[model samples]
Target: MNDARPPLPAPPRPVRRAAAALALAAVAGSAQATDVFRLEGFGAVSRSMGGVATAQDVGPAGMMTNPATLSLLQAGHTLMGGLDLVTTDIEVQDQATGARVSSGHHGSNRGPYVAPELAYAQRVGAWTFGVGAFAQGGLGTEYGSSSFLSRATGGLDTGLDNSSRLLVLNIPLAASFKVNEALTVGAGIDAMWQGLNLNLLLGADQVGSLIGASRVSGALLPVLGGLPDLRGAHFSLTRNSPLASGINAWGHAERIGMTYQLRPDTRLGAAFTTRSHMADMEGRATLTAVDGVAGQIPLNGNLKIRDFQMPAVLNLGVSHTVSERLQVAADLSRVFWSRVMKDIKVGFVSDGGGDLNILLPQDYKDQNVLAVGAAYQWDARWTWRGGFRIADQALRGSTLFAVIPATPRKHLSAGFGYAVSPAASVDLAWSHAFREHLDNTSLPNTSAPIGVNHAQDNATIAFTWRF
Candidate 1:
């Protein structure tokens, strides 16, 4: 009777809870949300005029879209910066049942992210030199952990958050040479930084199928009871927790551009950007079994991603002054999406344990963007601008999904600028794109056709100073 009950075995509850908390905090500081894959433009000036910066010498922001435009900057140095506030609403539904696939928390992932712009240029003799920073664009979509899709596989408590996030920033140090009055050539090196986080849910069937692929080669079957025969299984598996595997990479690219004065009143411009190859991403991936295997096992380990590169870009534009007070500009750009994203491969980081490999199909087709705008000097201190743009979708009919479902197709924009003073001015613009609806019936793994609708509204403001 004097036996003091052995101190209650250290409760396993605390240890389990601690492990869960650590997993959630993995991608904490680095998580950034965005909505658009490519921002229409870099600064307020570009945003206001329907992203028309290629030929008309907009400012330092032009250095990013078309470095040759740097040759058009005024003799003095210029500084400009702006912030973009964007909002997106997307809804994905099961085509057959008309039931929503997501949790109805539309655009919850949308955030007011900053698109910074900075540049300084000086003209000496026949050369103009400058440096600047800009954000091209990014994509962000988030769904609740207890979404309709999640519930289909297990109970509401199953932690399943499906989302995607990407952010890119570029800095260019460049020089422009006015070889002669009619022609200006420019070139630069770009320091590009990119970060990405992908968290997706996979059905047991899909995971099982991936295991069957020749690539996996029975290497992953031994894990978690040899990959259950999920063909008819009701449970699901989540790829990884956000913290486990996030990508923070750096790379470089080259840019060359030229502007030729077709006539005193007109200018033709072109710019080319080489593809940037980023370092492979390394992090941890935690795959948890739900429903049938609930709490039975945890597949967590280091993950490695192959080098990912953005597509090369080619832009050709023309700017013409119809009158002393009116100017019109147009640009056409080709993005080699097909070359960079034909296939995406993900592998496991073998630190003392075995790993798995998988290839996600993404045969994206190359796309083009067309933009046209007009700027009119309404008065000595006021200017008005308007423009329109159309961009082909990178993701096609079968591959579109609930995560990052909105791929913009067309945009309309308008704005104005006020001359606060000779050396200082402010610009503002607003843009709206109609909702795009996509129907997916051919994609594999879909029990029912998927339908998605996406719409957006964007606004920007920037202050510029000349010194």
Candidate 2:
């Protein structure tokens, strides 16, 4: 019945501090969410139904999902806007050292993240026109510059901050034609924008290794040894394009969708979104030289992120009314992730004044998502909804990192809506994914055992006005 903690083995002052610094930095700069950072749902009603909206015309979000559904909206002008509040958690443990650390509590600069959306649709003659702007998805994690990752390494004074953010936005203009009472077709043009900000610092130990192995050779090593070991080096080796000015790229894509009314209470829909061809992300990069090396090293005067593209997606859905006041729907989606993320490359200038590049192999696979949702009219002004969704992981073990944890495989959700007027209404929804646990020991280096547990919560509310 004894409950006590075991003391960790104490390494040298430098080793312990260095180990702690590297661990924190890696965790802080971890990749964004696993679902490839794609948001599950856009509007409150759709989110409440596990993002199953392909055939259901709940709001103006059709421009982002199934543009064909635009023609199905009641003849009028409709505006919809909403925001999502997300909470994420990441925890890591080093196997070689038995050291464990968390990204800090939920609210510790990591909690309550926000995403916004807006859509407007209008009917003119037989055509329905719509425009929408929204963050397709994003993932980010920030750790204080003075936290363990920095304190153990050298603190904020060294100008090494552990943080990363990846965001993608989409603006689409859509039009749908109602060919007949039974069918409608639509298409859209999307202006896609992507941006990234990453900062990773190598502590003294890694710096010393890099200097000894890459910079100095037999004769140079002996001479450099007389100066100083890189044990005191505080090198911000991977700080690239500040988010304000970093890798910002723009691209274009197309989407087509169709909706068919099979019966009085039944509908079927399909949609296809083309992959985007974006320009390479470029930015200036600088590195603090190995301590006592005299000056900073222009390692990457111009860093180029090569061949970054978004995947194409296909969706099939069905909606039906099984009872007088109840409707049910399901959607199946295919995300061609493997086609776009075979590998990630970073090209930079080497200290030797030559062009060099690093290729991080991804070898991702295609993934699928299946969602089923139901809505029940509880009263003249109230409706209740619930949904479930399951997805396949696209990333393989070789590509998984502590910073980029696995995406969740299961999601459970619930939500409700109220009609304030015939032309206006509001909806609210919430979803939760259980924690996903991962253990990685196969990384090339005899690195420590790295374990990460990730989980998330999403809450959304949207308003719709019909004019």
TM-score of each: 0.83, 0.79
Q: Pick the candidate with the highest lDDT.
A: 2
TM-score of 2: 0.79
**Candidate 1 colliding pairs:** 27-243, 34-140, 221-226, 244-284
Q: Looking at candidate 1, what is the lDDT of residue 285?
A: 65
lDDT of every predicted structure (CA atoms):
0.65, 0.67
Clash count per candidate: 4, 3
- Give lDDT for model 1: 0.65
The regions of model 2 sitting more than 4 angstroms off are 1-34, 104-111, 143-160, 201-245, 288-300, 349-354, 444-446
Predicted structure 2: clash tally:
3
Writing each residue's lDDT as its tens digit, candidate 2 over 1-467 gives 00011222435577646544543342232221225667777678877777787888767787788899889777878888888787777666665566665654412333456767898999997899999887777666555454443322232234355555667788989999999989999999889888766554444543344444353223333332454433232222233332243566788789999999999899999999898888887766653334434432324355667878888989899999875556788889998999898766656553445554445556788988888777766545667777777788776754555444545656777788877876777889888766777676653211344666767788888888888
- Model 1 misplaced regions, further than 4 Å: 1-36, 101-110, 152-157, 209-218, 224-245, 294-296, 350-352, 442-448
**Candidate 1 TM-score versus the reference:** 0.83
